[model samples]
Target: MDTQQNTALTRALAEIPGPLPARGVIHIAIPHTDRFTVVGNHLAQHPDLSCTAVGIAVRIQSLPQGVEVGIKALAARCREGEKRIAAALRELEAFGYLQRVRDRLPSGRTITRTVFCNQPTALLRPRQTASPRRPAVAATHQAPGPAPGPGPAEELTAAPAPAPDPAPDPAPTPPSPSPSPSPSPEPDMPEPPPVPPPPSFVTPLPPLFVPLVPPPTAPKPPPPPLPRPAEPTPELDRAATALLSDLRHHAPQFTLSEADIRHLAPGVAAWLERAAHPDAIRRTLTTDLPHPLRRPALLLKHRLTALLPPPLPGVHDLAAPARPRVTVTPFQTCDGCDRVFRSPTPGHCRDCREHRAHRAHRGDDTRTAAA
Candidate 1:
């Protein structure tokens, strides 16, 4: 009974044929009401970010505050090793999704602070050069000068001539010699020289908003055109189309529809016009068909276009030295039969010559008989 059941199962499996269809990722989303962390599409769908980096980012965002999220900590929590975790963290930092800063505490200990941003674009920080201290200007000091002496007017008021005696003195008092003028105050110290402004030390800052994606580079050059025959004709086109349609008969793998045949006909026509044999074209299109062949017309079109042969060579293309032209034989009339024939010089026709030879042989026979 077990043997019979096994045979039945084998037969059932044999009935199913052909390759299985390719499977692709399919999302079966279930909306979460609570205990879910909201992640922006910028980090989730970043083109440059790797899958590991995105996963690490999501995990870091979901965790509560005060949790150790360093490389070793993450490696312990997740299956990845420390090296991969560190690499992912670097990727996150580069794209502005995460930032790690070494902060110093009041107690003189330094610790790393990891900052995760859900929306890097909205909270993106601009990169700026550090601000340097401005240069100091030296102070200018001038030597002090002597103070100005009392002016002539102040001296007159300060020492009023001994008040004139109420009664006129009998003898004029010898006029006191006028006090010598006080020495002129020394020249005012020369004004101090002006000081120049300090040189600018602060570097100019780049644009405030940092782009999450790197700046675009120049576009690449377009590819060269595909090979093809120089000139095409209606007959060539028809023949090419027929060949393409008939491909399915010889090789079932290249079963193309009418639309595909029409589309690929021009490329085939190019191959045909280049003197490629029909059998060669068929073999080329059918040879080594890929297993589970899909889009046979596309494959045939590519081969036809890319593998087209060069045009047949002309007489001038020969490598040998040029040869002299052969002289044409002129038409001639046979001397005996007057039949027209071509020859370099006048001569009897072939039939007339053969008749003469036969008559000469018969005469010799007659002569021998008579003797």
Candidate 2:
């Protein structure tokens, strides 16, 4: 490989993100025409060989053709005078550009492979088609060429053309008439007999009284008793106590009163003990407490009470507020009298305003005299 080209290729490969894998680097050096040409061209333009060195190193390790150089050999070749070849190799390996393949015998030497660390080039176009004219020429030469035919005009007149036939006219056709037939008398059939009506009853029947009976009553099912949760054990109480104590003692800026600690100690201790033995702690805290007290007790002891901090003094008891800050607005100072006024309007300060008015009055007197 051309050293400069190879170096440039290496630099280009390094510019590409990711380390070159050993197998991949060996594959790059496998003398594939397209890859070799692409890599060679890339190296020609940019010769920083860090990427190439990594790839070369990887290839040298894995492939039979590789020099089987240890880290020292690679460093001597690529990073001469550098502190450590192993360090450079490690950096390359981290980049995914170099990989160790095997160690050399007895010398504690390592072989590494360098591979191109790049995304595969997606070919945008397929190879061009072979020329058709060459194949045609070959075919014609192999078998003798066909005999030359007559010129265009002679070939056209060689066969006499047939005469054209006359066209027929299209017209709608009239409908054909049907044959007449004689009428005949139809035979009559007998009608069905009518149904007879029932005779009316003269005597009235006595009214019947039916007695009402009540439906059999079903026994109502007894209301299902409410489900009661299992009671919490002593271990849960101890674990809870220890956890709360730890929180109060170790947490920043937190203080618990003696009364509050005493009230909560049993539960906290139970909680800690249970935490040490998780299997013993009840799944639900409300399981042990009476139904009426369960919710209120949890709210007061666990959540609301634990979060309470020592009372702070009211805002009114603090020191009085400081005066609001004020910024001085810049104003123009009179050049003639040194009087400052809050106006940026040009020539309008007290001195300049009076000076301009006097000049105008003088000019008016001069005009009056001239008139």
Candidate with top TM-score is: 1
Global fold similarity of model 1 (TM-score): 0.36
Give the range where candidate 2 is weakest over 10 consecutive residues by summed lDDT: 207-216
As for candidate 1, its clashing pairs are: none
- Give lDDT tens digits, candidate 1, residues 166-209: 88558867899999999865655565555555555555454333
lDDT of each: 0.78, 0.47
lDDT of 2 by residue, 246-293 (tens): 443433222445555456555444334323232232223323445444
The Cα RMSD in angstroms, rounded to one decimal, for candidate 1 relative to the true structure is 26.5
User: Model 2: runs farther than 4 Å from truth?
Assistant: 1-98, 103-108, 111-116, 120-242, 253-371
Candidate 1, superposed: residue stretches over 4 Å from native: 1-42, 47-228, 320-371
